[model samples]
Target chain A: MMQQTSDKKWFDELVVELRLRQVHGSAIGDTVASARELLRDTGQPAEEAFGPARDYAAALEFPAAPGHDWVRQALWPSLLGLLAFLLFNQAVTAWTQQELLLVSPAQLALLATPVVLVALLPLYLDAVVRRLWVGIAIAAICAVAGVLSAVVAPTQPSDAWLAIDPSPWLIGTALVMVVLSVRNTVRSSRAADDDEIIDPLSGTTAGTGAGARILVHVTNWLFPVLALAMLGLALALR
Target chain B: MSTSTPDVRATDGVDWPSDWLRATLGFLALRALSGGPSYGYAIISELERHGFGAIKGGTLYPLLTRYEAAGLLTTEWRAGDGGPGRKYFALTEQGRAELTRLSADWRRFVASSVHYLDPERPEKEISP
Candidate 1:
């Protein structure tokens, strides 16, 4: 049991390393299955049979998908959704209070913090995924920036740099979020098979269960769902 | 009870220089697959039984992957007999031809090396 757990962790690391290299899902699956086959035959621990997961992943030469494919497919849409979600959050409370939405330069800059961090993710994504501390540090920075943005928001229109009726902004941001979520959902369900890692022995993808489907759905709708929660909280507080 | 050599390192009884093994493992692997389709562990065992040192999967799989990409070897994943599926590698025609060529060249090289190293040969033949 202990060996199995460690081997599972090793395999998980291998998968992540391969993903970082942008190997196709089917090729990743085949690499994983073959490695597992050797381990079973030799009765050797995974790390012993294969060297470090990262090095092993680098050693295998598989045809990777185009390098910037994810940028077009996933990153841009997610970033846009994030922008819309932030706009919705800012507008929700003002609409709830039946007041104008106030925007200050400092507030705008602060709100852009997470968006900028996310945009720069592809640059250091491997380090962020490989090192736990990097991920935690980024999350901490985003959280601090989020709290500071709320604190700096103007209470009165006179104190704000720009003020406008909150109704259109609220409606527009919500529409954007919903549309992006729908598009993401459709794309994911269609592309899931192409991106899934299959276990050759079991004749199944890594996760084909109800739980996995639910997780994918939740991921597809995350931004909109969070926006709705923020709206409810603003209404309740008002 | 046995005497140990002063400069010898312990190994799995057959410890050829690592460089030599690294250089020849490609053709050796091709030769292994020449008999029939074989999985990774079987290929390693075949090489070890023939007096080559144990080859780690870490070292062997990458070479196999390269050959597969180069069209020298083809692979198939088949269900095992009451066990997990196995990925078997077989030599392509190109791989067999490569093995044949490498083996003949290696034999000729070995023969020349043996002739040059023979103590009974005249000094003038190697004077240069």
Candidate 2:
């Protein structure tokens, strides 16, 4: 049982390391399966057979996708979606209350905190993935910023830095979020998306089951669903 | 070019320095594959049987992966009998050629080193 757990952790680390290196999923799957094969054959523990996962991943030096390809395809879209979602959150309450969306400088800055942190993720992404504390810290920062942004929101126009009509902003941001979600869904559903790990022998993807499909759809539609929830909360509060 | 004893055995009781193994494991691995396509454990076993200390999968797989990327090797998955499939790695033509060249160079270097270390060998006449 202890050996199985250790091997499981090693394999998880190996997958993460490979992903960080931008290795293709097919190649990652092949590496994993091959490593498992050796372990099964020798009955040696994963660490003993493969050394460290990070070192093993580096040594493979598999041909990676273009460095900025993920940035262009995934990061930018998610960033845009996040920005849209934040804007929608801000505008929803104001629209529901039939008031202009009043923004204080402090509130805007606080609101921008999560977006900025997420935008800069490529820099510390490995640290965030590898270290539990780093990931927790980032999440806490984003969550605190979200709560503080609400607290710092202007209660009246006199206390605001800017007041703008909320309806157009609300609709625009919602549209942006929905469109981006649709785009993500389409991209994920495409066969050309090589993100799914495939079994080398069977040439079949690992997580193509119904549950996996639902999870993928949920992820793709996450922003839109969150926006709807926020809208419902705004109406209820009003 | 000698197919006999394709497995290179280390001298008895003297472990080759890791630096030496690290330097030569690449072509040595290619030479191991030169016999035919082999899987991970098989390759490691061949090396270990020939008295190369156990080459970890971490060490061997990466080298093989790089070789595959460089077109020096190609891999195929073959189903095991009542077990998981095995990834078999075979040398390409380029890999074969590289192995031959590296083997020749290594032999020459070893011969020269041996001759230089022989105590009875006469020193060459110096022009100066």
Candidate 3:
């Protein structure tokens, strides 16, 4: 007797195996199996039966974590704290100088402090594994900002661009933000699961998931663009 | 390839265990497909029928997948014709050749052992 079997039977079997493993979100193995059976009955190969199954598995196994969300969470609060600290310091300094409270670039940065600080709130909850690279970048930026503030702080008021001098206290605050940001980001990245192959420290593809694309998107576009905007704002006001 | 060479005991007189058990399983799997393509459960039951009940699902399933990947076995999906789904596996020409060679090795080993250890004794010379 010829034993004719349909391809759908084999596809159903594969579906059951994948379900037994609990591969993805809550999947009904029997239902998936039945669907596979239907496909096979139509004269499809086993490969055809499994295409959707593979995609569903990939999505569950690798969830994306956007870089902007991570950076904002970690750095926002710290930025606000620094701004508040700077503004308060400026207010006291201006009072001692007997000058009217005015919006200097430093004072404007001080006013923006709360926004920066609130932004840091998100960083607190982030896994250290996720923020190491962003932290490093922030640290580098702060160090450079500190050096510029210290060297260029003007002793006398002048209309010339070179007359401005950044206070040492302001420079010191930037350095502190840099150090804290680097520390938190590194700690968070290392604490995350090893399965996440992207190194949070450098925002680069370490190995696993869709890490390569996320890293490229973050490093080549997001952070650089934000950093450029920040520089432009500071230069324009100065 | 070096390990699979035909030398056997001819190699420096080393007494290799020869992994005979695994070879036997592979040989049986190949022969089991000669009747028709079968699935995991069918293969396990066939092995059980041959008095090799130690073969379990965990061992057989991985082995089947590995064999399919190695090109010694080919599988096709069969749907709804049976009550549920199943992946039916068939032996390839390479597997058939391997089974023939392994069967020959088993025969040679058995014949040599029986002839050396339990050679036929005359009825009158048999000890009580």
Candidate 4:
């Protein structure tokens, strides 16, 4: 029983390592299926037969998508969504109260903290995945920056770095958020469960459970959903 | 290359040096496929049955993947005997030719070493 649990973790690690290399989903499925087949044949635990999952993944040398493809397709889009979300957050409250959106230099710097952190994620992404503390530290930093940005927000035009009408920023950012979320929705829907790991013999694919599928769509629309909630909250307070 | 070939034991001990096995496993693997297509466990079993100490799947699969990548081998997923599908690896024409070339070179090198290391040979005469 204990052996099975540990082997499960090792297999999970193997999947992650392979994904980090940007290996195609079908290839990842094939690799996992073959590894499991060998384990069954030998009746040896996965680690014993395959050595360390990380090392084994590295050894396979399966062809992968170029490293930067995800950055171009996924990261840049997420960053833009994030920028729109942040702008919406700032603009929503001011629009609700019929006031100009206030911005200070310090507040803008604080707002950029998470965006810059996420932009550079491709460089330290592997490290962040491998180390729990690194991910937590980054999340903590972003959260702190968010709170600090709110605290430093200018209260009046005299004290503000830039004070502007909230309506245009509000409408524009909401449109960007909606457009991005729609794009993500279409992409994810088309992909469906195609990325799931499949068993060659059984023709069964994993990660396609109804709950999991729902979660993927929710993630794709995360920023727009969050923005809607924030707008609701601001209206309630106003 | 050495015509002074003397009658020697047809086989050596199974305890070959690790370095020796490392250098030649790629060729031995191709030779294993010379019989027919085989899967990972079957290939490992064949080498072990022939006295290569149990080769780990970790060691063998990567070698097969590399050979496949180099077009020296091809692999297929085939249904097993009421079991999960197996990935069968078969040598390509290039692989067969490589095996032939490597086998000849290996035999000549072994023969040269055996001739030079003959106990009856005067070592002092050959000393630099």
Question: Largest DockQ belongs to which candidate?
Answer: 2
Q: List the residue pairs that clash in candidate 1.
A: none
DockQ of each: 0.63, 0.86, 0.03, 0.65
DockQ value for model 1: 0.63
lDDT of 3 by residue, A36-132 (tens): 4434343444444334443433322322345464356445544544553444443334344544334436534434444453455455433322358
Angstrom error of the Cα, residue A111, model 2: value is 1.1
Off by over 4 Å in 2: B1-14, B122-128
Specify the CAPRI tier of model 4: medium
User: What does the TM-score come to for chain B in model 4?
Assistant: 0.84
Reference A-B contact fraction recovered by candidate 1? 0.79
Candidate order by TM-score, highest to lowest? Answer: 2, 4, 1, 3
Better of 3 and 4 by TM-score: 4
Better of 2 and 4 by DockQ: 2
Task: For candidate 3, give the docking quality class from DockQ.
Answer: incorrect
Number of colliding residue pairs in model 1 = 0
Worst 10 residues of 2 chain A by lDDT: A191-200
lDDT of 1 by residue, A1-238 (tens): 9989999999999999988888877888899999988998899999998889998998887778887988888899999999999999999999999999999989999999999999999998998999999999999998998899999999888889999999999999999989999998898787455778877666578877899989999998998899989999999999
What fraction of correct interface contacts does each candidate retain? 0.79, 1.00, 0.06, 0.79
Against the unseen true structure, what C-alpha lDDT does each candidate score? 0.89, 0.89, 0.48, 0.87
Q: Per-residue lDDT for A1-238 in model 2, tens only?
A: 9999999999999999999999999988898899999999899999999888998888887878997889999998999999999999999999998999999999999989988998899999999999999999999999999999999999999999999999999999989988998998898889867887877888888878999989999999999999999999989989
Calculate the i-RMS of every candidate, to one decimal place. 1.2, 0.7, 14.1, 1.2
The CAPRI classification for model 2 reads as high
The sequence of per-residue lDDT tens digits that candidate 2 reaches over residues B1-128 is: 11436556754444779899899999989988998999988887777767777888888888898899899999999998987889999999999999999999999999988887877877662223
